[model samples]
Target: MAVAPSTAARSIELPAALADWLATHADALDTSPALASEVVPRLAGAGLFGAGVPEALGGSGGDVRDAIEAIAAVAERSLTAAFVFWGHRTFIEYVLQSPNQALRERWLAPLLQGEIGGATGLSNAMKFLSGIESLQITATPLASEQGGWRLDGGLAWITNLRKEGFIAAAAVTSSEGAPPAVIAFRSDAGGTERSADLDLMALRGSNTAAVKLDGVHIGEADVITHDARAWLPAVRPAFLGMQCGMSIGLARASLGAAHRLCTVTRSGLLGRVESLQAELARAVGQMHEGVADGRFKSAAAPLFRLRISLADIVQQAVMLELQGSGGRAYLMNHDRNFARRWREAAFIPIVTPSLTQLQMELQKQAAAAGAA
Candidate 1:
C-alpha cells in the first residue's frame, strides 16, 4: 500500500533526514531486491513520490529540478532504485501534462500512490528507428470491445516490466491517413504476457524483460499522449535528467576507487586518473549547462554528446583503476559494479537517435552555419 501525502504545505527542500536515511540504507538497498523494493515505499513514506504531482491532485507540485535532485541523490547510492524513481516521476509528469484529464485522474493518482508500478514502452519503436530493424510488436484495434484496442506486439529489452502493474506508450497501427498515437494498459490485463527477464550486462537488478502483448485489450482511458511527434520533444529533457544522474554516479564510484588505489600505490598512473577526473568534471558541467539552456531541444542529440563523453571518461577511469590497483581490481566483488557501469555507459550511445546519426546531423548543422 502507498503512504498518504502530507496535509501541510511543505517547501520543496531536499531533507537532510532523508539523505541520511538513504545513506544508512544504501548498502542493503544496493545488495538486496527486497530492500530495493522498499525504495518507492520509503520515498512515498517520506512524501517524495508526490514531488512531481500537482497540488490539486493531492501532491506538493514540485518542479523538474526538485525531481532531479531527489533522483540524483538516490543514484549516488543505488542506481536501480534511482532508475525506478526516475521512471515513476517521468511517467507521472507525462500524465499530469497530458491533455487527457480522464487518463490523469484514473492512472496518475493511483500510480503516485504506489498502487501501480508503470514503465514506458517507447524503446521498442525507438530501437527500430535506430535501425535495429527486427521489431516483433504490433497494435491493432478490436471491433468486439467498445472503444477498445488490441495489441499484439513484443518489445525486447523493456525496463521494469516484471515488477510493474503496467507499461505505457504509443503503438503503431494499420489505420491510414492518421498519425500514430500512444496507448497503454495493465501488464496482466488478460492477454498481455511478459517474457523471461533478459540477462543484461549492466543494470542487472533493474528487472528488464521482453514484453509480449498478445492481443491485449486497451480502452480510450489508456491513451496518455495522442501526438506522436510531440512526445519526444516533451519528454526528452526529463529522460536526459536520469542519464545525467547515472553518469554522475558512475563518475563518483570510479573516483572513489581511484582514490583508494592512490592511497596504497604510488605511481605516474595516478596522474592519468586525476586527468580523467578533471575531464569528467568538465563534461558534467557542460552537460548541466546544455540541460539548463535547453540546447537539447529534441531527439537527444546534444545530450547524446555528453553521454558519449561520460562513457569515454568511465572507460579511461576504469583502465586507470586497474593500473593503479594491479590485478586485484579484476576480482569479483572489487570492481564488478564498476564493470557493469562501464558496460551500461557503452550502451548509451547505441540507443535512439544513435551517436553516429547524431554526429552526421551535427556536421550538417556546423557546415551550414559555416557557409552562412
Candidate 2:
C-alpha cells in the first residue's frame, strides 16, 4: 500500500528577510490598522512583492508556485498582511501576463525593485467576466492625438496605498462592438478619486477602498489588454490560482491554533478538531497538486472546491479553539485570539469566488455536464 503524505508538506519557502519582518510585525499587523504606504516598501524591499514577476523583466525570476508558497506563508501568520500582498501581487501577475512590452519595461523593473507600489482593481472585473456580476468601470476612445483611451468609472474592491501608487484596472468600451480593455492608472493623476477607507471586520488594515475615475487618460504605455474579456481567458487561471494562497494559509493558521490548544480539551472536542485538521490536509494536498502539475485551468473545479473546504475548516478550527481554551474572553474578543481568525474565515464566503457564488457556478457546471 502507498504511504499517505504529510500534512505539513510545503513546496516553496519564503525568503528569510520576509520571514523575519513578518515575525516582528505580525502582532502589530493583527492588532492595529497598519498602513500600506508604510508597510509595502518593507515587504517589497524584502523581495516579498516580486515573486510572480519574471527575471527578464527585472524581477527575481519566480513563478506561480513560488508566489503561492510565499503568499501562504504570510497568510499563515497574518491574514491582513496576506491580503495586502495578494492585491499587490495580482497587479504584478496581470502585467506579467500582458503582451505589452512598453508597459512591462516601464513598470515591471521598478515595481519588482520595490521602488514603487500599486493596487489591483480587477476583482470586480473578474466577477463581471465570470458572469457573477455586471461590469461597472468603463473607458471611452480618446482623440487620435491622445494615443489612448479616457476612463470614467469606479472599482470598489481595489487596494490602494500611496497617493502615487499605480493600479491595474479594467473598463468596458464606450462603443458597442469595441472590446473591453485592462489598463493601468496612476493614483494621483487628474480625474482619479479614492473614497475614504472602508471599515472591515477582519482585514481592516489591508487598505481596501473604492476608486472613482473620471476622464483619467491613458497612453499606449498603460494598456495591458485591448480586449479585457478576451484577456480573461489568458489570465483567469493564474488569477484563480493565486487565491489558493489566501485560503490555505488562513486555514493552516487557524488549524494550527486549534492543535496547540486542544491537547487538554475534552476528547469529543479534540476529535472534532482532528477531523477539521484532516480536511485541511486534503485541501492543502489538492493545492499542491495544482501548483506542481501546472493544471490550474484543468483543475479549476477541484481547486475551487478546496477553497470552499478551507473556509469551512477554518470556521470549525477557530470554534474548536474557543471550545478548548481557558482564556475564553480572548477567544471571543473581536480583535483578540481566535476571534479574529473567525472573522477572517467569514470573509472566505464573500471573497471573489464567494461560497454562494461558487455554489451557483458549480450548479451551473453540473447541469451543463449532465446535459452533455
The candidate scoring highest on lDDT is 2
Q: What is candidate 2's lDDT per residue for 207-315, written digit by digit as tens?
A: 7777788988888788888888777755766666677687778777776776766775655667777788787777766776665566765445676676777777767
Off by over 4 Å in 2: 1-34, 266-268, 291-294, 326-335
Give the TM-score (vs. native) of candidate 2.
0.87
For candidate 1, write residues 136-164 as lDDT tens digits: 54556667737566777766656655364
- Kindly state the number of residue pairs that clash in model 1: 4
Off by over 4 Å in 1: 1-39, 42-62, 127-137, 142-145, 267-275, 298-300, 331-372
* All candidates: TM-score: 0.76, 0.87
Tell me the lDDT of model 1 at 261: 82
Task: Kindly report which residue pairs in candidate 2 clash with one another.
Answer: 180-228
| Lowest lDDT 10-residue stretch of candidate 2 | 1-10
Question: Where does candidate 1 have its weakest 10-residue lDDT segment?
Answer: 1-10
Residue 178 alpha-carbon offset, candidate 2, angstroms? 1.2
